[model samples]
Target: MVSVAEDVAIVAFEQTPSHAHFNDSEPAMIMPCVNSVIEQVGMDRHDIDFTIAGSCDYLSGMPFAFVMNIDAVGAWPPVYESHVEMDGAWALFEGFVRLQSGDIDTVLVSGSGKCSPGSYREGFSLQTDPYVHAPIGLDPRTQAGFQAQALIAAGKATERDFAEVVARSHANAKDNPYAQLSGDLSVDELLAEPYVQQPLRRLDCPPTSDGAAAMIIARADKARELCDNPVWIRAIDHRIDSHHPTLRDLTDSPSVRIAADRVGLHDGPVDIAELTVTYSPEEIILRDALGLNGETSVNPSGGPLTGSPFMAVGLTRVIELARAIRNGDGGRGVAHASSGPALQQNLLCVLEGDG
Candidate 1:
């Protein structure tokens, strides 16, 4: 439970658009973000203590997707590095752990995914329990619909409540050039749209997106040297809920709530919160569980409802949260990332501008 702010800090942060399409190949787009980060932080590629990344090929329809991004780092002279088949938040978690060892002064963490090339529903269905759920052919959207109905039945939420969340997200995305979907909608209009699934609709879910992002982490003194304002990590933690839908409560995401508290996200009211809730209704469950009220600025950048690129979604939340703190956009904030059906796995990071 040792916080990195007592030792390390986030010096630089960068990200690409969370859009629905890109003509560029995976590596082609990824390197630009990496290079942009390298230039912004005023560090040579070799100066990076270690490099780590996250990616998955199933969505990209190409195996070895992560291997292609290795070139992005100019990782010659064999800079120490590793990768995860998991989301970039997990990779970011690994990078922070390495930084905590007190040997390396800095590290770089990045992730990318292009989910626009194929039938994403067919693609995402594959992440389900291979034996039971896959055979049933349940896609993420449909599963979310089932969960939404259950939430209504449990009286935790109503159809109109979910629409309000979507309306807010789209409106918030208006100022974010990176957001894929932006609009001003009222609760009635969002509710009137036909459901894409029983309870989830086209607007409630994220479009398939293509994107990448990178961040720089440095020890305390080095963090201050690299940037006038450094966002210090107070805590980073993650946890998992049971994977089987029947075994869990779809109305509440225990994993997200627990992870947030574990990271001291509620030490006081956070000034900002970057949440990766891809579907609209999932936002309600996450917000309630984390004890957030109207005061906490949630997803000011529009979040994943604006765009979702599979494995890259989680890391983008972390990067945006760091940037908000480092740029004087906010004073204290919590970065919330999620994965799997109904927020099955979650990561919470608390960051502050103060050293």
Candidate 2:
């Protein structure tokens, strides 16, 4: 586990509703979320010691597109900031590490994306190996199909299991106002729908969404001063597996297990777990990797399956778990994030309430 030099806690977080087509600039999507998080703690833009963001320039169809998002956070005064080309969860990783230096007291982390104007599947396919997978037109959906087939072949899960996960996710999403998709769906109803990919129905895939999320984190003392009940970040760890799909088991996530061990996920009972279940089959793989039992509530906010806003989806998981903890729904919880196709890289965060 990474040793904590100065304990960090999330004081406040906010996210925009996942929209099918935002029809706005990325900054417009981010402004409200950024404003709300700072307002939640009664802090001004200048009060934050540092700021960072996560986004994909490729998704914007322009290089250095992330630079344009600084308008939301205010660059006129010239704030110290940085950007990561991954998910907002990775930006949180950097923010958490920066605080350990003991020089910065607070950080503003944000992520936003607009996938409506472009083909997300084609865009994401570029992440594959250029020399191998990319040339064959292998996309995430096809990759997920392979994973589902592998699960069935291995007897680890069945098509019905995948349907059940989708049903539960939509059911749980009914309570999430920010969710773009939610309803009391049934496995039978979902199964009757035609398969977009064999063994993986259309419902098994995450919807393309446009949204943003922002969070304010601070050191222990500052966290206490900022919020009445701060959710402490107990441990955080991440790992990556081979980029080649052929090298992976498909049915298992060794990276998740390694990160889980490093974060001490089993040190105590888990009350909730918010995972990056972008695909239905991934939920089964993640559960097996994390060694979670029925006692732990998984994806209570409906997860990415309901509303997956590329850059913001991962960090939203952390935000959801923190919200649950603050509401007294649970004392301890785990939040997960993923990047790359077929869960190539994974991040896990453990959180706890002050009690």
Per-candidate local distance difference test = 0.83, 0.93
For every candidate in turn, the CA RMSD to the true structure comes to 1.5, 0.9
State the lDDT of candidate 2 residue by residue for 192-239, as single tens digits.
999998988988999989999999999999999999999999999989
Q: Model 1: runs farther than 4 Å from truth?
A: 1-6
Q: Which ten residues in a row have the lowest lDDT in candidate 2?
A: 69-78
lDDT of 2: 0.93
- On residues 1-355, what C-alpha lDDT tens digit does candidate 1 reach at each position? 4345446678777788886788878888788888988888899899889999988878667778788789887799899999987778888888888878888888888888888887767877888899998888778888788788989999989988888888889899898887888889988877889988878778888888999888888888888889887887778898999878889889998887778778877776598899988888888888888889889889988889988877788888878777767667888898887777778788888888873
Candidate 1 vs. true structure, TM-score: 0.96
| Per-candidate count of clashing residue pairs (backbone under 3 Å) | 0, 0
